[model samples]
Target: MPAAGSSLGKEVASSGDDLSKRLDRLEELVRSIAGDLRDVKQQQQGLGVAVLRLENRPKSPADNNAEVSANGVGATAEVA
Candidate 1:
């Protein structure tokens, strides 16, 4: 017959192993989320830079004429 204390010891060791495995999985999930957040922030920063470049770009002839018209001023359209 097995000793009573041996069964209890086995159960305690099994529970500890299960707890360790769950903790490892939780740590992996946290690392994955942190990586994803870094990627999103990088993409967001690129998008902002693109928007700034567009906003600071030189205006074309058509854009200039449009702005003049929007201000209720008469603009002569140049024949290209």
Candidate 2:
């Protein structure tokens, strides 16, 4: 019975060690993922700012020309 008890203790200790190692690996994985998410969030913010700038920018020369040509005065000016 003493030998059986010693074997049971060894098994318990082995399982506990395995559980600790797994927990450590899980913690490391979570930390790595969290870092990646932070980087992605920063990139997304930069993209958002760029999008906003594009949305609010002034029209190009082509757009201006189109607008002017839409009016009759622009064509008359070109002839003169």
Candidate 3:
């Protein structure tokens, strides 16, 4: 029969190896999550710039006329 001390030592060594493998897997997952976060941040910045450009763009001719009428600009008198 194997000594009790030898069996306990083997169990401890096996547990240590399992723990090391789990830590390595956790590190890989963290790296993957960090990369995904960076991609999302970059895409968000691009979307912000696109929204700003749209907001600052010139209005179409019909839209301009509607705005002018709404603001009572360039009104003319009607002939009887």
Best by TM-score: 1
lDDT of 1 by residue, 1-80 (tens): 46878998999999999999999999999999999999999999999999999999999999988998999799677899
Instruction: Give per-residue CA lDDT, model 3, range 1-80, as digits (tens).
Output: 56998999999999999999999999999999999999999999999999999989998899889988999998888999
Query: Looking at candidate 3, what is the lDDT of residue 12?
Result: 100
In what order do the candidates fall by lDDT, top score first?
3, 1, 2
lDDT of 1 at 12: 97
C-alpha local distance difference test of each model: 0.95, 0.94, 0.96
lDDT score at residue 62, model 3, on the 0-100 scale: 95
Q: What are the runs in model 3 whose C-alpha is more than 4 Å off?
A: 65-80
* Model 1: lDDT of residue 26: 100
Clashing pairs in 2: none
Alpha-carbon shift of residue 27 in model 3 (angstroms): 0.6
On the 0 to 100 scale, the lDDT of residue 26 in model 3 is: 100
Error of 3 at 46 (Å): 0.8
lDDT, candidate 1, at 75: 62
